[model samples]
Target chain A: MSDSSSSFISNQVSDISPVQSSTTQSQRRGSSADQDDVILSIRSLCKSYFDAEILQDINLEINSGDFLVLVGPSGCGKSTLLSCIGGLTDVTSGEIFCRGKNITQLDPAKRDIAMVFQSYALFPNMTVAQNIGFGLEVRKVPAAERKQKIQQVAEILHLQPLLDRTPAQLSGGQRQRVAMGRALVRDPTLFLFDEPLSNLDAKLRLSMRTEIKHLHQRLGGTMVYVTHDQVEAMTLASKIMVLNQGRIQQFGSPEEVYKRPANTFVAEFMGSPAMNLIRAKVIVEAGAVKIQIHREDRAPLVFIEQAATDALRAFNNQSVIIGLRPESISDVAARDPQRSHSAECRIEYIEGIGSDVYATLKLGGSDVISRLHGDSNVSAGDRQQLHFDLSNISYFDPSSQLRI
Target chain B: MHSTIKRPRHLSCLLYASLTLLAFFVLAPVLWLLLMSLSSPTDLTKVPLQWIPSQWDFSRYALLLDWQNGSGKRFLAAMLNSLIIATSASFIALVAGVLAAYAFSRRNASMLLMFAFLATIMMPPITYILPLYSAFSELGILNTKVSLIICYSAMLIPFAIWLMKTNIDVLPEEIEHAAMIEGAGTIYTLRKVVLPIILPAIGATAMLSFLTAWDEFFYALIFSSDLSAKTIPVAIADFSAGRVTDFGVIASVGVLASVPPVLIALFFQRFIVSGLVGGSVKG
Candidate 1:
């Protein structure tokens, strides 16, 4: 399975234009030479609590100015991994290299990192300015310099008016901004965030998400962020690492992870409403690979062409899982024109979410959702012709749950 | 709607009346003690108990405060001893207990370990008083303020730990982690972050520990035989031991002895209430 994925990755790499590939190769060489561009590198990191293993043999390389987001469900070791990098939690095994230095066993303070926590974690006793300047104070930075840097960070975060107010006096959003300001004032090599926006209301979360993205763009500093919210992960991250049960399921660009998830878990976990996993069997017909999807009442023999069919040729006549995102399957008129497989199914439920309409229907004996434009008139109990864009579909081995 | 509003109003009136009656019963003894402290010796000894004495005199209080006399000197020394011992014991207990509770709360110590630490508080203090007395005597520190301070601190440490632990447990652990990431060490984090947030709990614990040491009778009685190391409770007991038992003098001493703790409670009542409620609810 690993061999096949490696080949697949190499093939994808080869498909990139030659000039772009050469530049990436040169950048890789430059990174290897000085190791200046790679801000943090974790090698075979593992953490365990007595008998329970919380993080397993994890490896990651984060580049300078990269917004890397580690996203997973609760207890999936995303936060633990972040803590390990921040030196708040000790790794059971493995090396953590920051700026080419082995810092796995160093003190968190000595690691030259700043972290913002979900609870804001502002010092209730200190005013906003004092909270932001605490790191500078601990570093024995002179009072005059600390004041200037704090003022600058406060101005950037629009926290000048809250300088005299303690954390309890500020609203939740203000506290969160102060937390970010505290981290920003340090000017550390890396910033670690553990669900920093999770405590805010939905509107505030969205705005903060945008603000953090803007901050990343402005500062161009390395960051390792952990969140369970996929939308935040997708919108803010230059790279996304999907984790499950203390193991990294996939690590890639957000588009790569979304379009070609490495496993069934990543496919289901990364998308809201989740990708529909339809049980199907592959069949080689007329020297071309096709899939046989058996429905509940009528078995519609829909043959879809996907680029991965060649790799899945050996699994012909065997049951496999087909992953289709909600947006990939839509009304016929809303589907992409390149390659679409159309089928008629009775819509069981309709959910209008202002901009889009989600219709749940039975496909291949399993419930699959189709996302259509809001103006696309469709209702429950209606026989709708659903067009599934097969170009971006994923195939996985039924037993192993690994993408084929 | 009218009936519902009226019903609550009537219920509140009944509740207030019952609360007032309970307060009167609870305060009656203290009020009597105050009245006794104010009455003249002749008026206090009168039959039917002069609830409101015709003549009030403060001569007993004056005598207690006259440091030139032997009795007044002993009373002043005892009061000073109580102050020193209570303050020292509570200060030591506060320092030791806050550190222990922080470790217990953050380190994820086993349940058995926590229960074992707490087991000391659950056991009766009298059970180990004999051993403690022997140890202090062998150390040649018995009947000294040092012995009483150590004993009182030992007794209060476990209770202080329990209270501080519950308060610290409710504080989000991420705050401490954030401090660490901000280049602050464990001591700095505790002082700047954890200490300030849990200051109320510390205040309440200190007050309670001081009161416990101030009012302790058994340890003070067994440990100190002289006014040099005796506390207020022991002094009050001594006041009742004289031949003919001057009730007026005893009441005066008792009233003075009760003042410090009452003042402390009144001064820090807000912190005490919130700290106790925070502890119990989190537990």
Candidate 2:
């Protein structure tokens, strides 16, 4: 058991060596050269209302053309953070630098940031063309120039046909497009969106999301998008910052955050159906580690020679949380022989959603769902052997709630 | 389909019946006033009430319009005074009230301050008449159009603020935030966005303020000694006070005085309905 675990660790170390060296080399160069590309930098940002803190110690650096999304549950301060960046809300304490200048005390108008609100905020009294060109008008741009710019933005947003219509006359999606046109016409240093797609129906929301992503690609401007929808963050962001309870849970590329969440909150928050958390005890036996998961009315399943034994050494005989996404577990027939860890459990229920099936099973006295491709042959009350992919499993310290 | 059509016919009959009833009750007074304005002096003094005058005499209207007759001169001066007072007072109140309401709607101003402004509206104007008269006299502006304008504006400003504030509150704050982000200052946002959206409500409020100022008799009666500053309401009241009261002339003055308000209301009827309902619903 010890030999197999050690071999796996050595293989992972070898695999990461080249990538690690390149990353460190880039880090050395990034310190100075990257500073110029940092379009926005927030340092020690804290905001409070009365005695209650709303945001704390928020430090972030957004680079040029980076679409950074602040995502969390309701009341998690994602919108507040976006507001601080846009200079709409004054920070309680902290400095925000935009284009290498501190804009902490600046007015929203002076900040050179455009924002698209959830309500679209298109002036109801103004025509689509007027709404799109309003910022230019405010800047005192000449009428011809403003018209040309509005034309350009309207063309890009496919709003040419609706130019003369007021916001009330346009459909919800059209209104959102006009809002995008308004923001785009400014060509500001940064763009802030506060749950801009929340008001649209699901179908429109999906299309609008794609449209925004395409716009981001075409414009390549720095934008900070705030949303409670993790799917939006996953799809739209170049870097996703997961916030929970006014603090950052994780900030990383989508793959890094999804595959390796920093903590339990992120693990639960980032994925649909969420990561399945199971309480298990670690046991050290003869220089190897085994996980003991106890089940009610059944024999305990002891997983031997887990690959994470070295990291689990200190946690021997102590409770640790095992996080596995639904896709990680599958029926025995569908499991890859070389990559899966098999376990026996009784199927509790089955939920079929079109192309896939989800089997609910009792494992270690907890309900664990296994996602299977096509129809799952397993039925309720059937004792089934489920295979869990070992490589994507996350281990967390129960006390600290941090990933091990 | 047949049942649906039949039901609508029945419902529409009931609707039309109620609407006719409402129209009669509403227009009866105006119709009666019109009849009186056109009645001969002898016809007005008859013991039996005449819904339709046997002889229609428009001489009273002609007398009210002409500046030659003493009563005509007094009526014209009072009408002019009412016009000036209503227009100026309503304008002043609207301008100050819109600015105050915008400020009150913002987060910086405490709710207590809003309530304080609203508290002024809760007090009846009659309660402040004596103090206002003393202040006006002390300022040496009594019996002047400016004094009446000031008094009317002061009386109506609180109401304007309350109505405008509710209407402004219903506007999306995000629109203001969007404007601010677009390099627009507070004043610019108000001018370009806020004002246009709330224009209908402002029109409604202005009409209301103008009518209130135009109809106010208590303050005008106490402050003005003659036709120089007295409004239509006071002038119409004065018509009944002589040894032999001319009911036809008095009714003529009342009808003339009502024309401005009635015309303004008719012209802005659409705005009035929307403005009144605007506060309770989002745009």
What is the clash count for each candidate, in the order shown?
A: 0, 0
Question: Candidate 2 at B86: error in angstroms?
Answer: 0.5
Candidate 1 regions off by >4 Å? Answer: A1-36, A295-299, A304-309, A332-338, A341-349, A379-387, B1-17, B108-139, B270-283
The residue-level lDDT of candidate 2 at B56 comes to 84
> What would the per-residue lDDT of candidate 2 be over residues B1-283, giving only the tens digit for each residue?
2554455678889999999999999999988888988888777778887668998888888888999999899999999999999999999999999999998887556768777767876887788888888999899988998888988898888889889999888888889999999999999999999998888889889889998999898889989988779899999989999999988888889888898999998878877677555423122
TM-score of each: 0.88, 0.90
Candidate 1 structure quality by residue, lDDT tens digits, A1-404: 64464454444433432533244345445333333377899988889999998987777777776788999999999989988998888899999999999998898889999999878777777888999999999999999999999999999999998899877678889989999999999889999999989889999999999999989877777899999999999999877888888877787778788988877888999889999999988887777788888877666657756554566998978989999999988875534566777878788999999999999988777888889888879889988887778878899888778788
* Winning model by DockQ: 2
Scoring only the second chain, what is candidate 1's TM-score?
0.91
Tens digits of per-residue lDDT, candidate 2, A62-86, equal: 6777788999999999999999988
Interface RMSD of each: 4.8, 2.9
- Each model's fnat? 0.67, 0.72
Minimum summed lDDT over a 10-residue window in model 2 chain B is located at: B274-283
